[model samples]
Target: MEPVFEFPLSLDKHGPQTLARRLHQQLRAAIVEQRLAAGTPLPSTRRVAQAYGVARNTVIAAYDLLMAEGFIVTRPGAAAEVADLAQWRQMAPRTRTRTRTRTRPAPPPAIDWRKAQSSEKPIGSAATAASARGFHLGLPDHRWFAADVWRRLLLHSSSFALPDAFGYPSAAGRPLLRAAIARWVAYTRAVVCTEQDVVVTSGAQQAFDLLARVLVAPGHTKVAIEDPGYPPLRAALLAAGAQLLPAPVDEYGLIVDTLPADVRIVCVTPSHQFPTGVAMSLARRQALLDFARRTGAVIIEDDYDGEFRYGSDPLDALQTLDREARVIYVGTFSKIMFPSLRVGYVVAPPWLIGALAAAKQCADNGGNVALQEALARFILDGHLAKHTRAMRKRYASRRDALLGVVERELGEWLIAVPPSAGIHLYARYRDRRQAKRIATLAAHHAAGAQPAGDFLLDRQTTFDSGIAFGFGYIDEAEIEGSIGRFASALRGSYASAD
Candidate 1:
């Protein structure tokens, strides 16, 4: 047996305090200060009693007190062990330090991040919680996912047989994962590419950041983006020092004629526009590609939620139609699987892939190889495809539930722009007065949502005031009740538009 670890203790045999109480206090202070590390195995009660020249009963009582206070844990047939002291640390008060005075460090040098991004209030604050009744934009139905399958795949992919898994992963990504993604996107999004053209990213957001690094030249670069667009994309490009040119979006999608001729990059979400739920017309898709070809600008096509179309044929990706290699296709597993997975990819032209890969190396070295490996297996084994099909049906039902309530009960107050695909549906009110009323009601019920005006680059610019309902996270059964709450909140807040 291993010898019992010794801890210094000066117990007074003639003191007024009992031996057990003195022992308990010393042991607790040792544990709290980490003199005895967490998870360390404690000696047997009899052994501790003999080592300290005390009765076995004295040690037993002290151990019991420690266990009760969560300082240690004991098992029926095993040695008692120290419990993790993280919670205890939080509970303990800070030690007073009257002997020394602390001085604050000097402030950092001022930085001038010249007008590249917005100074408006953040869309959602850090403290905001994801409520069950809240309409989370672009979130998927997490309940429908197979956690057991993912757990097993993740465990199985953790073996270190491959050299990439053993050491730092390649900046370009694991070869197997890159190849799997190439095949997957080719099959699903009709994107044309090989493993050599694929660059694995943390997510589509990082892919955009990497592109901005390699493509944009700070103040000299002009980048065109869809107005009332994906806010994160616009913000990221602006932070990279690109002069942003916000173009307008119509019912058909981004108007190609309004694109600035001098811009070097154009970012769009054509499959399903964010905040509006509008898909670009086929003519518009072609016109976008032609515009990129003519202007010699790189097209960044972010297909974030293209996997879950409700009732239409999947359109050919902009990359598929680009014969001039002008489009950079960005895809992610966030919406389909889950956001925290942080797995997204970029299919760039042959000449640009190397530079982008190098830029990624300088950014984060590389992403988690084990997660990417498991995801690759998830794709090749057809689990991804199977899960996506199931989620599509469930989300479609949810979409119908929300629309049904709007059309049946709230027709006078709102008008839903029928969405053929994607998780969210956009609804415009007769005016901002009605929209604000509905918003106030939704907030009262803890069912939060975003106003369409939140995405506008220029609030003064003309646009419809509406709310976007992301039905993916909210259950179909709860949709009616949530709408009812909205109706109740709106009661007496405004008169019916009769």
Candidate 2:
């Protein structure tokens, strides 16, 4: 077993216990330098007591202090991880902005005619909690992934890949990874692509940002997104100064029949709609493509986690059926491999990849090459498929646990819409007003309360409102409890909304 440092007797005294304070200082420094990583196996309470001749509770108290300050995470059976330093850097305070606009402008009727996308907020809402760990959105548990193999590959590749990769990696990404991605997409999403078709990105968000940078002509072009959709997409578009429109989604996905005539790009999650787990129908897909072809618009297909299908044969992705080369396909291992992998690919129409790559080169100077090579080998070595299969089962089990918890707790109070695929599940309140009230009071209850209103276009009819739960990140033990709390919160909110 690895030797872990523990508190000494002198450190435990409430007064000037120099040794205890020194141990604390050294441990904090180790954490800062990553000597102690987030989730490292620390010594046991008895072991610490035995090692240092100090009381077991002294060690416990010290660890507890570090944890409360966001320095570490402790699981029941697992060792503590070095609190994510990268996440910590992101969580630093920025200039806070208060909403000066008393209310939203009265948008024109039928204004959604020009946008193509969903699940986005109007402006980047301060990216406030980036550093605090245990986030609830699009985060899959990485514990199940086979890291040893990738670690080996990264180690092996780092020695030889420096000359070609370190200085200026291809704007198109490494050719080997691109080819592997091409193969993965053909078999999985059924999209035909060469290595040239793939432009590796930081994640799907970057792909959206890149497209917004290249396609949207600032205020001159209007973009449409799904009403009550992903907030980040809307924020990215707005940040690019695009006039965004919120398109309504239903059982069929984005209602293309009502789409505006002038949109240059349509961003969509047809395989599994964001937040709401509805799959886009084939009829809707064809209609969207038809409209894009007629309008000369680009279709940005974010095939996010389309592989975890529970029932029904997976429908071909929109890009798979695009004959006009109008569809740009986006896929991310961020969901499948875990969020930190941060590698998502854009399979674009031939003309767009070059511009986007230049933008990428200028932006972040290419992603981690070692991780990229590791990912490439992972797919080539067939670990990607195996990991996906394992995770699908794990997630499926988690999904079952979530359903049981909601039914057991909320029962008739919450209507659970079972997901076909994705990390999250969505719900509409039987008493939405009450649900809102509970969510609003979540801070008081030590929970989060995100209203569905922020996702809508300020039109009451546009909001098919409910709660969003990212169940994949939470353990089974907490699923039922979370739902019960949510239901109870909703009960409280019911009184407030009235």
Candidate 3:
């Protein structure tokens, strides 16, 4: 097979190396070592010749021999690539980034100059001033997804006749998948929208990006976000170069009566408010929509976790209540399926769906089509519905298990804000220092356990000001032990705080 990496042209012209034989051996070694994985495109013939100081004919002969040996596959016109590494079983994810000390001279442009670092800080932290130990507020529980099905779908999709699917995919995203999304939303979220209204996007991040691009006109627009809300939205709004006004929220959710005068976009998480798990009251939903209508502001309904509510029946999505086409609904599969899925959709007003679709097309040409199809089929075939129901039951049980533990063992240590639904709840310790320590202790027990302060900026963000740990991602057996450690950590942390 052709090598996964660029073939070294450094074989000695008159040395003991057989130019062709040496090339074949190197190719074989790379494939065997699993460095040159299957399907990786090899360097061009012209480039290979230039590298080895050999003629193009020599490289071509070597490549042909490799192909003959079933080591590589050469497309008629495209670059020669290694055969699929179907046999290579993937192991553990590289938690630590490995740095290489190379003897070769670095290239001028410096393309491969540095390797990825295993820094404790995430990109989200570096840019937003968010802490690494923040609450599980912005992201979803990735462990709940059926990733194997999607992976199989990816393999099948690549094996299809069309790689790019012959031509430009729909800017609104794949039609079959969109239809699936429409049906899935209808069944799961109880929202009303069709395939025509669904505009596939990178994720809720890009949903905001595309929506902001179309709706918000730099200085002329003002968008309202929850007072103690997602920083990413605030970051995105600021980056979008729009003015952000903090809308007040309380027990029932964002105070509709206190909205600002000139907002063109209003972002809300009616299902479960971030940080504080308050469901928006029906009165509040109507008032918010009414306020939007009166002021002509488009309500940007961030239904990020609306699918996972507890106790009460499904609440009609705010967009369903929009008669004036005022609600721009953004929903994501990241929470329900997996975050890396990066698949979200905006059911824009029918007239404006075209504009939003155009914006999406320009953003990244409608996301990964194969993934979209796989997810679409998954949802359409009822696997998503079946799996979501199963996970909800599991998460709800864990939530209860945690609440029960804290109630019995460490009741005095926290302030509870239990949700009617959603995977996480907020708890506060009177002393902020204690909160940090408890989170550290919790992490010593479990890997990703953390406090809410991590998501907050010292300047703008606000919440109960506590550590937020999740039982949703872990087992019931671990909860009691985790809580015990959490309590011990809190006491020790506070003793030091004093």
Q: Which lDDT value does model 2 have at 224?
A: 69
TM-score of 1: 0.75
TM-score (all chains, Cα) for each model: 0.75, 0.69, 0.70
- Local lDDT at 115 for model 1: 48
Model 1 lowest lDDT segment of ten: 120-129
Which parts of model 3 are misplaced by more than 4 Å?
Answer: 1-148, 161-164, 430-450, 455-464, 493-498
Task: Name the TM-score of candidate 3.
Answer: 0.70
- The count of backbone overlaps in candidate 3 is 5
lDDT of each: 0.81, 0.72, 0.71
lDDT of 3: 0.71
Each candidate's number of clashing pairs is: 0, 27, 5
Error of 1 at 389 (Å): 0.8
When 2 and 3 are scored with lDDT, the better candidate is 2
Candidate 3 residue lDDT tens string, 1-498 = 443245343466676966787777666666755667778788887777775577888778788888887778877888888886544324213322357876777656312112211112221222221233222334444465677876777777666554567567888899988898888878776778889988888888888888877877766688888866676666666666677787767788998877777777889989887766678999999999889888888888888877776786867789887889888888898777766677888888887887888887787886677777777778877878877888888878877887787766666667767777777776667555455555666557534544555544333544456545554456677777767776776677668878
Model 2 over residues 287-354: C-alpha lDDT tens digits?
99999989988888878888777766888899988899899898898788766667888998888888
